[model samples]
Target chain A: MKAALGVMALAAALVLIGKAERPETGWSFRLPPGFPRPRVPADNPMSSAKVELGRRLFYDVRLSGNGTQSCASCHVQSRAFTDGLANAVGSTGEIHRRSSMSLTNIGYASHLTWANPLVDGLEAQALAPMFGDAPTELGLESAAQLEARLAGDKTLQGLAQEAFGAGGLTLDRVLKALAAFERTLISGRSPYDRYVGGEVSALSPEAQRGLELFFSERTECFHCHGGFNFTDAFGHEGAEPERKFHNNGLYDLGAGAYPKRDQGLIEHSGRPEDMGRFKAPTLRNIDVTAPYMHDGSLATLDAVIRHYEAGGRGGEANPRRDRFIRGFILTDEERSDLIAFLESLTDPEFLADPRFGAP
Target chain B: MRSLLLSLALTALPACRQDTSAASLSTHRLRFIATLDGAAANCKSLAAPPFRLRDARLFVSELRVIGPDGETPAAFVPDSRFQSVEVALLDFEDATEGCEGDSAEHTELVFEAPVSSVRAVTFTVGIPFALNHQNPALARAPLTAGAMHWGWRGGYKFVRIEAQRDGVEGRIHLGSTGCEGALHAITSCAHPNRGTVHLELDPATQQVALDLGAFFGSDKGGDKTDCMGEPADPSCHAGYRAIGAAGKEAARQSDSLAANTTNPAMGASAFTVIRRTP
Candidate 1:
């Protein structure tokens, strides 16, 4: 009996230690070094179940009213989550006012939508495409309709409950799950990242020279698009807040109009001074997400370079152009080098990675 | 066991002390009413009344409360600053128009009294300097979601008053002038063509009057014109030229209308004091 009691005591102690050693449950996020996590809403905490559910929802066409479009319709995973279209078309066949932005590393974005400054998080952004009256995408105006739709599918209902727990399948819960999934879609394993992480042979000679020019103060490309993400307006798991908008002299269409279709931040703020200001997109896969700017007017990378080289469109005569857009003269070889460097940002492995592909 | 209890007790002592200190901070109630003039008062009512306005919205921003005792220079806490305070000119049902037209409407703003030694209150007629300098995409609440945002013009309209006369609606849109796009590269654009109005608030009085006629010249004679849709109308620009030589005159008139007015104090009686109950 004495021996058995001693053994039981030892067993209990070992069990306690094992319990302590067990990793915490739910989702745990560890942002890459030098990367910061964007601010998450207090209501929605990140969880693995919710993220998995949101991933499925993001790819599911059933979220749309007519079951025709999903978040992936405008944001293809192959092209760094940005569709090749100049302007995205809604599920209802209405043309969007602005170009579709790449969702790569969008978890670190300070502002979510193109023009709306109020949409600071993914949860808020999901609402616009879901219920916004002006050019509606998913016509989820009634809660009953959403509930019935979710209840129609047994698998989706189970997934929603597991993801949202006692909160049930609500609009807010859907938004939270979608946001969680987006937060997990972190992409930082490019060759450039490897080069920055101390690998000497990661970059070609031309790419290295291009990187130098990019970082150089003379070119000043790094001023707005700097740091690990190549965009200064980055917020992540632990980064300090940064500005989300800049006037890159994309348009000076004269007489206080910013190219009728693409009003940029002006449409949202309605401030005259805010006219023509747009969020600077991340250059993670610039080679894939072509037709740059809020309007997607520039088709080729060379055209974008030339536009920056000559200040802006409508010539040096535009009175309303931003000060930073002073037309800089770039040599032909230098321009090509910059293009090569930009191409190096593409992660071929990321494109072919099956983990992110449609299941 | 005794030591564990002591440790818990000691850890909780600081929190109790902090709670007591936070409870001691004084809070005050603020109340005031804005009076309008000219078409402002008339616009509130569909039926024509003397000294009435056609559109009765009041654009107020940068609310600063002076202590109850006297005017004290206080630093507005960051993120606590307000941009534009809007009092709608008309009240309408979800889809249909209400019987009552635009009248002098009352607005309420409340904030924790920063300092105990309260005096009077003051506020600017336009957005605060800090928020005004920020990118419009980042501005939230009372700043971006207002009629004052004149999409891409680059500045907040300090005052936006609209009125209709002789089958033509007149508007007074005021903001920073001499704005030369974002690419000018200069730190300071030219000074606003117009000046700002400084409002001194007396909580006891609970009434403030703003004259509306000051925004325009005599509507009876000298070519009564409209500034509404002036961006597209060459004739409107021509009319402005006849009114004054440059846009500076219009801006100045807007400033005067925003600042000094005594005629249309219609909503002063309805002013409600915002006070925190003990």
Candidate 2:
């Protein structure tokens, strides 16, 4: 009996030592020196198992209702996680209200969906694409159907269990896993990051000038999109909490409304003054995520800068435009330089990283 | 070994006993009922003229209870317990489903509370100032669900009263006004329509009734207004003003109902309270 007890103790110690010595197999993420990791929920703790499961799910077409589209369908990694569509088309052939936003550094986003205040966390935002009836993507409203769909694949079941203990069959667990995977999709190794990190040769002369213009108070680009992440409203681990929204005067069709289909935050609040307000997206890979804004009306980065330079859509036509959007004209050289600066934000390492791509 | 186990058990006993005592002292049940007492207004559609309350749904949140003894300042408690109270909408019965011209009925909001230790209870007609100032991410329960959780508006709706009035069915939704951008600036934003009301938790008068008639009747000229649709319309603006006035009056009456037993307030007198069998 004494010998058996000794053996048991030895095995337990070995297990502990093995756990301690376990090499980190997953991606190694580190926020910029001055930056911080975005706030993550306690319920969905980050782990390598969960992140791997999320990555697989993100690329899997079976996640959609018709098994035709995956998160990757709209968010291609080559394009910096944004499909260059004017507006994303869901699996059901329904056009989305807005363009597909770039997933680069999305973990720091305060508000998940465009113009939606209710959805704050990535776990909660997963519900919009999975179960939202109006623009159904995954169509996992019925638990039974979701269970049946997931049950067909042994690999998915194993991944789900590995990520979410024994009770990993639920929709909430799936979403939590997906969110965990998305949070790992960090891209901070861009040329801009290198420049910020004191590397002199990181940016060319023209790109440096564009960067100066971006941070300059004259252009006022930093007012909306500030901080290391280039977004004013960002929340992350150990970072000061900030969740701001703005009305850059997207449009004032008439009668204190933006447009018929997309009224932004005004429809939710039922306030007249809240018209044309939308959350400012991260400009980490602005060159890739084309068709900007909530409606995806703008097609290219040049067009987007022109829109801002003109002060907003209908700047000369509409009188009720936001006061901040006093149309300013930029020189032709300045426009090219701004585009170059935006291109500098692209992390070549992220786009070429095998971890983000399919096996 | 036995002695050590016994000592640990004995030491843990006090904590369990203290928990029971604390729970016993702070668990009281309270019920909030909004009674609709008026003939339903016949309306064709939500946008049509003479938009009346054919069918209406009311969503209220930020529920709180204020004790008459005044021990607790107007803080937001999960359950109604003492001199301070504030509660907002969580959910409501859809009024649009009912037949037009039917006599409206009362909807009961029943929840468990520990209010025996408190003197009086007061509640905000809308969400509390603190909760309103918080990010929508922080708001859980009652406030998170229903129409009150308007995305990006920065605050919950104080009152969502939908009614079909005079052949025009429309909603009268009231939230914090003066929203500039997507992010609600707590200091800059204004909720002119928001007000507070108090309820005296007397064993004699346990039940309270909130009437919808006064809200509709208060705005005499803005009869054809609809605050739900076409928010920029003059009629809608006038209707909002009328509703805002009525909410203030109702709050004043509710506050008075807590203090005076014999002389009930305008809407308080109509309420019938029944004691639960002990």
Candidate 3:
């Protein structure tokens, strides 16, 4: 009896130590210099198996309602995971008011979408494109049909079970896998990134001058788009979720209200003050994600810069424009230089990496 | 030495087997349901008075009861997946059972404690401030699964009641007001604004029915369903009246039932009542 009790004590100690140990073993990620690890939910710990399964599901056209589109369809890896469309067309052929957001470095984002404050993590945000009925994207919220679609394929089912550990083909497991895979989409090997590190020579002389103007108080561009990720809204383990939203003077349809249908955060809050507020997406791979803003009304990056140059394009000078968005005159050389600095944010390696490509 | 250790281990094992207090335990599975106009509530009726419940989610915490053995707080019977000490969220809208939007048939708040000597049960309507602002990734079930959380700055919605009367949507979203703090943690809130409900009954043989009909005074399908934490707003009339009757509007203390007094919690008793089983 005594021997058994002693063994039990040792086993208990081992179990306790295991519980305290870091969940990230093969899940560990070495983020770029100054970049922090993204916060992983306690319930859904990061694992290689889960991410591997997610990568497969992300590329599988069968995951869609009609089996015609995958997440990779709208989010092409070569274009930095952006669809490069003025307005995102849903899998059901519904034209969305906004463009598809780039998935590059989305793991660090605290606020996931253009405006909906309720959507914070990648797990919940995936539900929108997957199941939203108003403008159905993938249209796979119904579990029975989704399971039936993936049922015959033994390989996909095997991967699902391994990722979820016994919950055979459930929505929760699907969501967790997708979230885990997205968290691994880290992009920090750009020219700007090298300059941020020790190598100041990574950037050209013109680009370096443009960088000063971008971060300088004169342009006031860094107010909303600051930090290493180039967005004020960021979150990591142990740190608070910086859920920041802003109206960058994109629309001014008189009375400070944006276009009726495209009035960003105000649609949820119903407050005039919150009219055109939307999440400022990270500029990690801004070159490919053109036709910007919440509504994707601005056709080109040059048009976007010019909009800011004139302060809140379209209609009269809106009252709801952000305080930092004061119209400034830029010379042709200065304008081209600003564009050059934005171009430096593109991570070519991330776009070409076969790891993120369709399986 | 081995024998001594074996005896000790056996003794401790039995003692540690039970997590709660070392008292006589009686497990009671409580069922919570709502009624409309003194009848069983239905949100799917399509006639002149459509009884179709579009959405209804209630968040109640700090549950305590005065039992035959005195008073003790009721701790939720923790499941293998999630557990909590003080708060309980009772969901009544399951999609199949006439509910339009939701899918879960989770209408009961289940909690266990030694309550054989119990005479009455008490609970609050909203989340406590201590746990409200904590990291959501770390919080369990009701805090996580439910759509109660209203972003970092705004905090959780105490009671999210959305119903359609004659195809019109009426919503009441109750939450903490004058809250100022960081995104993750709200350090302080001027008005906790939570409603307390304490009912006199025995769980072993009786049931409790909360009449929401009294709460929805004149549900004319108007936009009076939304309450943005304002006391004077017309949309909050039903909600304010219901919360007011549950406790002493002046004092948030569980003991302040305010049975005889005007519920100082909100204003008028709106449409609120506590029915007991014989």
Alpha-carbon DockQ of candidate 1: 0.03
Q: By TM-score, highest first, what's the ranking? A: 3, 2, 1
Question: What TM-score does candidate 2 get on C-alpha atoms?
Answer: 0.56
The number of the candidate with the highest TM-score is: 3
lDDT of 2 by residue, B131-194 (tens): 5544433344444322343333445555555555555444555555544334333443423344
Q: Judged by DockQ cut-offs, is candidate 1 incorrect, acceptable, medium or high?
A: incorrect
What is candidate 3's lDDT per residue for B1-278, written digit by digit as tens? Answer: 32343234334544233323434455555566666666666454422345456556667776666665566666666553223555666666665544443565555556665556457777777777776655443366656522455542346667766666666655666666545444354555545567766666766555656566544666565434545554435566567557553233335332211221223454324223344443
- Candidate 1 regions exceeding 4 Å error are A1-24, A30-34, A255-257, A314-319, B1-278
Report per-candidate TM-score of chain A alone.
Answer: 0.87, 0.87, 0.91
Model 1 lDDT per residue over B78-172, tens place? 22223122211111111112211222233334434334544445443444333443433245544532234433334455555444444454555
Question: Model 2 segments beyond 4 Å from truth?
Answer: A1-34, A254-256, A314-323, B1-278
Cα-based TM-score, every candidate: 0.55, 0.56, 0.62
Ranking by lDDT: 3, 2, 1
CA-based DockQ, model 2: 0.05
